[model samples]
Target chain A: MIQFHNVTYTYNFNTDTCKDAIKNINLKILPGEFLAIIGQTGSGKSTLVEHMNGLKKPTVGEVFVSGQDIWQKKFDITKVRFKVGLVFQYPEHQMFEQDVFSEIAFGLRNNGIAETKIESLIFEALDFVGLPHDILNSSPFDFSGGQKRKIAIASTIAMQPDVIILDEPTAGLDPYSSELLLKKFKDYNKNKGKTVILVSHSMEEVVRFADRVIVMHNGEIKMEGEPRKIFTKVEELNEMGLDVPQILKVFLELRKLGFPARADIYTVEEAKQEFFRLKNLTKGGKSFVK
Target chain B: MLNNMMVGQFFAADSIIHKLDPRIKLLLTFVYTLLMFFIESMFIFTFNILAIIMVYKLARVPLKILIKSIKRMLPILLISAGINIFLIQGETVFKFLGINITKQGLCMVSTMIVRIICLISGMLLLLYTTSPAELVAAIEKILKPLKIFKVSPEEIAIMFSIALHFVPVLLLEAERIMNAQRARGAKFDSKHLKEKLKAYITIVIPLLISTSNRANDLAIAMESRCYHGGENRTRFKILHYSAYDLYALLISLLYVLLLLIFNKLDFFKIVM
Candidate 1:
């Protein structure tokens, strides 16, 4: 489990221009849980997630990972980082190797894995991300935008980290590619049972993929719960400068129109099922409005 | 760790220095630097120090930031002083470890050190008060006259501004790549220089590739907008020299004249 104790981060400390980024954050992230950290821009969601992998340290509090303070002396913070793979926003900028194969292999090499097993690991990660083997020999910079995103992701996945943290992974991709990537993340989370922390702005993606939701406003966590429970409080979230899923909004409007519909449907699939059930109920020619 | 760097960073504030026109500020900076060459005495240097302090007071930049900026130049300051001690051969006033330390050498090193401190402090004051956007605007305006000689000042301005714009972008990219590599267990701050160099190579290669990609994107965007470089382009904000600018220029001129008067009197030898 990853835990934060009264964590607070102030950028440029002791300076007049210092800003309180995240304040007194206390939370725990259980292993193998798909948690989505949702907040508007500049709400400190990124700062909160960046602490999980030791990219940043809390100024006023301690962060514990698996019963040990990772920032303490002699803890091998780099090893902690290796176990918690962090894919930053626009992670494609991390691509360094000439070919796609080498790009993916870079991580494994850092982990000091044997040369004989590195090739297979690279292929497994590529296959996981649905990247073609034809681009293995070509320069990684030669690919299309979506393909580059996949290759960059594959570079992180080859490490087989215990916890994979992605910051706005699908912000710039096409709809189909984003959906494909989200599905891949779900498979990674379920099949491998690794922790997946997705920092996103899209409530729809959170509703579709995440099992738990964290809502943030300013520099504090406003609420946290299961997706269904969190989306049910539509007014509270909207007040924090965030919107619920479109389906939830649609259902809320439907209820206002006196349809007696559920206002907490979070995903398209859930919306479809609810609408079909409502359609069948109305087809009986009995008064279902009550 | 790179965040501590204060050189070329703007400190947002509303002060007399910040209110001065950037074009006038740039010109005054140039003139002040030229005047530093004629200061031959410690008294003149002392006066320059006072003048710099007064400028800093007007700029309202915190002393902590100035110290941080000068700290980055500490190594250069020491190295210059060390080398000058041996290079300036004259009447040897003292001996240390069988090496002669001349009176002239000591004078020159002190002057050099003071000059560097003043130069850096003055330049950082300008940078601290003037935002990068304003700096670029000032440069484009100052160099506008070069267009008559087929110099293409607008293209030069565009390049300058783009390069300035990329400093922070690339710094953030480097941090991202650094973190990504660190997550992969790449030891960047190894004890051995060779190991550190190798690790840097891993980070720099990607930065280079992304730079090319960014340039291509910028070119495409510019072309789409019909950017044909400096042909009858009208600026949104025209450069205006107000009474404050005139006052600032006259003050700078008076300061330089004081330095000349002090140097001619050989008044600093009393302190020496």
Candidate 2:
């Protein structure tokens, strides 16, 4: 679990160019939950998540991980990083080892895991990311973009951290690959009961998978609730330069046209079910379909 | 740690120096360096320092920022001055722990320090006043005559601009890679040299790959846009010499004339 108390981060602090990246942020992430943070670019989303793992020190307040203030004088930040893993955006760019196996083992080796145990963890992570065993000896650069991304994720997961924070892992990936990657994280959250925090711009992805959503704008948390509750405020989201899921937008439009369609439907399956129920009602005689 | 570098960073200000043509500024900087080397008397050095201070004030650059920029060069200044203080052979004025401190050495050290400071400040003044884009355009215009030897000025200018543009960006990428490695428990603050070097390898290899990958992508994007080696190309903003540039050139000439005159009048020389 992580908690932020009155945290504020200012970039270029003590300089003329200093500007607040995040201001007075108070947040708590419970154990074993999938939380998504959605925001427009430069909305302090990245700055907020960087503090969770002690990668960035807050300018004003404290970040407590598991009831320990991370910035305490005696506390070791490296140990905190091992407990809270952060997979940055385009993590594949961080790959450096000669081969996939060593690349995946990089974090484990850094954590001082025994040589005998690193192999098993590497293979387990590769299996979780759906990478083939034969490619272990191949160089990571020899793989395609999607496979490289998988290798990067496998590298992070091999460390077996308690909390996993991903900053826009799905960016620049094909839709199918994006969905597959998110599904893996979902399984990691559900089966392993690990805390998963995803920073993303995709509303559909967030609505489909996240249990709770936090919307950020102008360095402040503007809204926080379940995806269904958050997506209902379409106008406010638009004003913040964000969008709701496409299916929810369609349903909202349908409701605006005097149909009985629910404006809260987000996923395609829910939208389809709502349309079918409306069609049945229309077939009965009291219909607003026209 | 890497953010302290002031290389190639432009400070924006609304002043005559900022508005002067980049070509003129570049030429004036060259002339200033040449004139600095020609000084052999303390009077000329003092006059040069005063001129730099006056120009710095006219440019409206913050005093603190200028001092901060100079602070980075302090170690080099100290090392060179220390070497000159004891090494120069001249009249011995004193002795410290078996080392002879010479009067001539002290004079040489002060003169060298002033010259170096004046040179650095003059170059920084040029960078602080001109934007990178304007500098590139000015270079292209100045190098236009090199086309006769099968050289392409536009290509050279584009390369210079791209290199300048990516310095800060690549620095940011390097920082990002460093943070990612740190998240994996790589300890960069380790005191052992070998461990520190190993930690840096994680950052270096990834940064190199990403740099090449970015270069490849940029090349493809440029090619797709039908870039054909800058042949028959037109510029969006053409470089032009204005009255400000002329005035700047005149002032620099005047400074050089004063320096030449001071070189002959050694009446206020420091006795060596």
lDDT of 1 by residue, A1-290 (tens): 78999999999888667898999999999989999999989999989988898988888999888878988988878777778898888877777777888888888887888999998888889888898777799998888878888998998899999899999999899999999999999999999999999999888899889999999899999999998889888788889999888888898888877787887787778889999988887887866454
Q: Which ten residues in a row are the worst by lDDT in model 1 chain B?
A: B1-10
Best candidate, TM-score-wise? Answer: 2
Clashing pairs in 1: none
Candidate 1 docks with a DockQ of 0.73
User: Which residue ranges in model 1 land beyond 4 Å of their true spot?
Assistant: A267-269, A284-290, B12-15, B131-134, B226-232, B270-272
Best by DockQ: 2
Chain B TM, per prediction: 0.94, 0.94
Instruction: Please give the CA lDDT of all the candidate structures.
Output: 0.85, 0.89
State the lDDT of candidate 2 residue by residue for B121-182, as single tens digits: 88989888899999999888889899999899889999999999999999899899999999
